[model samples]
Each structure stands twice: as C-alpha cells, then as structure tokens.
Target chain A: MHNRSGLLEACLLILLKENKSYGYNLMNDLHKFGFEEDSLNISVIYRNLRSMEKRGLITSSWAESDQGPRKRVYEITADGEQDLKNWIWMLKNRKSQIETIIEKYENLK
Target chain B: MHNRSGLLEACLLILLKENKSYGYNLMNDLHKFGFEEDSLNISVIYRNLRSMEKRGLITSSWAESDQGPRKRVYEITADGEQDLKNWIWMLKNRKSQIETIIEKYENLK
Candidate 1:
C-alpha cells in the first residue's frame, strides 16, 4: 500500500529535485524511507508520478538506459522544488507530534 | 480525514491506556498530536475506536456524566497495550525515514 501520510509525494519530489532519475530508480530509493514491499508498490509510485506530472510539479522525458529500453526520466520543476520545501517544513513542523506521542508512551511506562 | 499513518490507533490506544476517557475527551486530546480540524475528523476516530474494540484491542463502558448524558468511556485492553508498544517501536524505527528526507532536503540547499 502507498504511504497514506501524504508525505510520499514529498519524498518523490525531493528525490527528483536532487537528481533526475527514472521511475524504477526512484521506486528503489523510496525503500529507505520505510516504503518497503508491504507498504509500497511500484505502481503506486508510478501513479503518483503521473499525478505530480499532471499537477506540473514534475516533468518527464524519454531517455535511453545503459542496460535496457528507453525509460521516462523525471525531474522536479520549480514548483516541485517549492512544494518540496513546503513539505519539509510541514514534516519538520509536525516532528513534535510524533515526539509527543513518544513522550506520552514514556510517561505511561 | 483521519491520520492514515495507522498511528492514530496507537494514539487512541495510548490515551485509553493512560486513563479511560469518553469519545469527546479522546477527540480533544488528539489535537496535541497533530490531529486537528483539517486532518482529523470525529467520525473517523469513532470508527477506529469501534474497529479497535471489535479487534479486541480495546473495551468500552457506558458511564453517567454529571455534565450530560451517559458517555461511552474507552479503556485499553491488554492486547491494545501490546499493540501500542508495537506501534511505538515502528514509529521510532521509521523516524529515520523522515530524518533521511530532511537530511536530503538540507543537502539540496
């Protein structure tokens, strides 16, 4: 399942902004962020990429890969960069929420 | 919308574990953890509460309130407490995922 926290978009945005990459590479990279097989699916990432592209947050182009067929390479647009920044701010802003839950747990114990 | 991270159940579990509380109070307490007007809905909380109860994670009792009509007070069951612990561990484990995103953001600047 796709991460429902709505932060997956931010993750994709940040990844694309940092270095333009193909969908497969992007999907692989998402694993580091707790988007494992159980929680994430490649199709979901693709759908989100399409959705982001439609929203103009990202753009894609056909590019030849060394090992295989041509792939669609995604890059973050200026709008995507700004949206990424906002997402980071929001995540950092809400860091305390998770921390608060942790704190409550500690107190309970 | 309810928090889709699946941590909302943990939050509710923690609250009930700490002290048995009625629905309204539990809803209000959720705000401290980022469950606000935009992201959290009362109906969703109730649904989750019912789901948890059905799952044998929590139990509820009706109590007379001086302020008003009888209210259903919820308390965490043994299974619920264990579930809360598991959730805490999972959140802590995934905390780095968020930090990784933040780190990537910093590197981009």
Candidate 2:
C-alpha cells in the first residue's frame, strides 16, 4: 500500500471487530488482506496499535498463551467501531474524488 | 480533504498541465476543485511545490506580473506527467481497495 496508514488503521479495526487477536495474528490477517509482509513494518503496526489504544479506539490486555509466557491481545472498542464508520465515509468521498481525477485525466487532450 | 497530500499533488499537477500558473491562481483553482480554502494550508502547498521542483517533477520561474512585482510561475515537467500517470494508476488501485472495504463494512452484521 502506498501511503495507506489510514487504510491500515481501518483494516486493523475491521479485523479486531471480527475477533480479538494478538499482534502476530493481526499481522497475519493483514497479509491475508493484501498487505505484503515485506512492505509492512511490524514496528509501525505496533506503534499504530499503541496510538489507537491511547485514543481509546482499541484496548490491549495481557493474556496467557499456550506456547508463550503471555501475549498482548487487542480488541476494538466502541469508539473504534465509530471511527471505522467515519473512515468508511471519508474513504467513499475520496473514492469519488479519485474517480473524478481519473475521468478528467482521460478527457485531457 | 483528510490526509490527502498525494491527491493535492495530483490536482496541482493536473492544473499545471492545463496551464503554467502562479501560486495564487493555483490556489484559487484548487478551491474551485472542491478544496476548502479555510482547510487548506498555503504553506503546505508551497512546500509541496518546492519539493516537487526539487524532485524534477516541476520547474518554476519568476515572471513579471501586471500588478505585482513578480510572481513565481509553475509548469509541469515531462517527469511530472509520468508521475501523474503513476499516481492515477495507484489511485485506481486504492479506489478498488476502498470499495472492497466499504462492501465488507456494509456486509458486517
């Protein structure tokens, strides 16, 4: 994704809403959703997760894992759902704008 | 526009392609293209313009104006046109991704 930080956030919200997950699982889900592992920075996702938690969009808690001592589990908050809705609305608006630009480009002579 | 720096660059390129314009006129054109003047930061546009020039996507020159001392005129370079094409391609891809996300959101229950 090219400069898709906001899109990444929206995707994370959607994934968490589907099921509360840990960082590793979320990263895997991101790959499943078209994000290239090589292009994605794990630290960036963690930073975004921390920032979202600070903003009350997500909450993280330590959970005992079968193979590990403990893992941080992330769940979307009500605010995250609302934020996702807002993101969708904004993205829809942007989509139309992009279409307009493309149309204009095609018409250029 | 919410975090639409790339979109802004595309719009600027389109406008410059249409005509080599000065900063003020470009800003006005942007307003006509759905950008709210109040929401836009003039400095950011100038910063982007300077950055584009530095990257050889655009070139600027000082021109004598009818009523002002001199104004900086901006023109899109050949590289800029190619960059515009790339931007359009990327934006098209992003548009489809956005549509997919919107569809997923709508289907969520």
Candidate 3:
C-alpha cells in the first residue's frame, strides 16, 4: 500500500489473500499490525472495499458469522490480485527513489 | 510520510516547510501533487494538524488572509522537526523490510 489510506485496503488484501473476513476480524488484524484501537476505522475499510468492488478488484456478500449481524464478507478478485501485484512491483522498483527522499529529509549524525 | 493517512499530514508538513497556508491553498497544493480534487480532503489535513498541535508537533494561530475568513496558519514546532527527522530515518532503515514484503507479494513473470 502506498499511503495510510491504502492501509485498510492493504490489510484487507492480506486478509483476503489468507481468507475472507468480516469487519471485526479486519479490525483485530489491524490491531495486530499496530493500528491504534481507536484509530481502527472499519468504515474506511468498508469504503475501500466498495471502491475496489467498483473497480472489479473485490466482491462481497452478506454472510453469516459466529458473531453479531450479517457481515459483509469480502474476497479478492483476479483484478484485485493484479492490483496488489502491481503495487508490490512499484514498491520494489521505487525503493531507491523512496530511500533518496528519506535520506534527504533525514539528518543523522 | 508512511501512508495515505499520512498523505494530508505529510503534505501539511511540506507546506509548512514552505510557508503557512490556508485551507483552500492547501487543497490547491494537493491538486498540484496529483491528489484528485475530490480526494483532497482538507478536513483530514485540519484534523491531523489539530492532533499534531495536541502532541506539540505543530502550533497554529489565526492569521488574517486577504481571502474570506480567518485562516489558521500553522508552523512546525521543534518537536515536529524532530518527528519529521525520525520518520525519514525510519523510511530509510525500513526500505529493505518494505521491499521484502512487497517482493513476497509480487510475482512478476
């Protein structure tokens, strides 16, 4: 993921890559990734899923979970896999560019 | 910055590095950075500034601009500078970690 906004989505992809999940599971996983508990905005995840679905990257359906209500379960589509692959490629090739920017901003003695 | 959530805030720091700016100006600046006009949420920037101010990373004061209302002109605090420095350092050191993760994600064949 390129930015904080991509965070939830990135996590979503990681989760979907493993298995489809509901909001609570995603939120819990985010906590594992060190996202502040209060800062875990599930709505952002939901919104990103919606956008990704619109882009043919993901698909969702109301599924019954052991927990509360009917949750939206999401799975990665072929396009979603492709998008993730491309993002990873960018991260690989842009490593030097990212390093340069960071070094210019950071002054270590 | 590290993520999209940090985009607005990172842009905020960059802008503050240049000069104090109003909301509209910040929005315009985001457009220059290729943030979709609609995706350029000034509210997130304002919120990050408020949080940064709370953490003593930034300070703001009402400044009379030639525009409509009193705009909050924010400047980076000493702590903010140090935070920026540390973030940059992390960006440098974590480059390999990031690349490794991205590589694990991507399969370019």
Candidate 4:
C-alpha cells in the first residue's frame, strides 16, 4: 500500500547520491519533488532509511547540527547506486505500460 | 503488492470501455498492450474482474458462443468510466514525479 510506483525509494536514493542528507533535510527535499507532506511522513522516511541501511544500500552517521538535535546523515553505497539503476529501469518499464494504456483510452475517447 | 502502478485495472477498464469483452479475449488483448503472459495471469485477470464487478465498475453476462464454451462478457459501467478518468489523472501525476527524479539523476551524472 506504500508507494506502488516506488518513487519514494528512488527519490531517497537519488538524493543521497546527490549529497549526504539527514532525515529532516530529506523530508524537505521530498516536497520539492512533488511528494505531499502527508504521504512523506517523518516516520515513513525513517522506516525506509532503516530498511535501506539494513539492505546495505546506504550508510548513515550521526552528526551534530548547530540549530537542532543530532541528525543522522545518510549516504548511498555502491550497492545503492546499482539498485537505483535497476529501479530506474523498472520505472521506465512501468511508464511505458502506462503510456500505452493512456494512448488506448484516448483513442477510445 | 499487485500492480502498484494500477496499470492492470486501468487497462481492463479502457478495454471494456472500447468494447464488451470476454475474459479469454481480454487476456489476448493484454499482450498487445505490452503485458507479458507470465505477468498477466488468467487468475489475476479474473480476480480483477470479480473485484470490479463487485464494486459496480463493470457488469457481465453469460453468453453462448458458437465456437467454444460459454463466456462471461464484461462491459464498463458509468462508474467505471469515471474511475478510469481518476486513474488517468493518478498515472499522469506519478509520471510527472518520475520524470523529475530521472531529470535530477541525469543532471547528477
């Protein structure tokens, strides 16, 4: 029931690859990519982070932040990079299928 | 876990809208739309058909076919048309988000 498109995980990996980011900053970045705040909850982000770390796709380090509490900054691993590539392929595949359906529907209209 | 993109449902609705179809013919049409036979199981199609009928999105009638066994031909209902529109909107929304992520990654590379 969570992100059937798997966009959230892809975005997280891409953002981590772009730069090491903490959960709070990642949450903010998600908004920039069109994710709703309700859908991109803090707990959901944390859960995915933990799962990704467990999968050896990402690593995190606790760092002291000047304005707030210590933050866990995450960085994508080599495995994570490869996984992102696979996800990209899957997304492209799904996109094509969707486009085909849309085309069929438009023709019907 | 089934069709996170909801493409299957959308395709079925669109096909039904185009013409009333029996389950067997629908399976063949799916191949034309890029769905692999292995991925598009007959059972999966029936399950969706039953679910849609239960939801009042489609209606089916048993018919006698001269060439083979009796088949239940399905046609989209009024509610189904509305639902297809909603699915189209959702698909477009998800597509935009995926494109943004792909763009960001390409820029990173």
Quick one: best lDDT, which candidate? 4
Q: Which residue window of length 10 is worst by lDDT in model 4 chain B?
A: B1-10
Cα lDDT, model 2, residue B47: 90
Q: Estimate the lDDT of model 3.
A: 0.64
DockQ of each: 0.64, 0.52, 0.23, 0.65
Report candidate 1's interface RMSD in Å: 1.6
lDDT by residue (A1-109, candidate 1, tens digit) is 3425657898888778778997889888887666667677788788999998998999999998789899999999989888888888878755667788888899989
| Top candidate by DockQ | 4
Q: What is the per-residue lDDT of model 3 for residues A1-109, given as tens digits with 9 covering 90 to 100? A: 3334243555567667777876667778756444556765777767777888899888889987676788888888888888777666555544654554454344332
For candidate 3, what is the DockQ?
A: 0.23
Candidate 4, A77: how far from true, in Å?
A: 0.4
Q: lDDT per residue, candidate 4, B1-104, as tens digits?
A: 23356788898999899899988899999887888767778988998999999999999999999998999999999999999999998888877887888888
- lDDT of model 2 at position B70: 92
Model 3 CAPRI quality: acceptable
Give the winner by DockQ: 1 or 2: 1
Kindly list the per-residue Cα lDDT of model 2 for residues A1-109, writing each as its tens digit: 2335378888888889889987777887887556655867788788889989999999999999889678899999999999998888778777788888877778774
In model 3, how large is the Cα lDDT of residue B88?
58
Error of 4 at B17 (Å): 0.7
Whole-model lDDT per candidate: 0.82, 0.82, 0.64, 0.86
Model 2 misplacement above 4 A: A1-5, B1-5
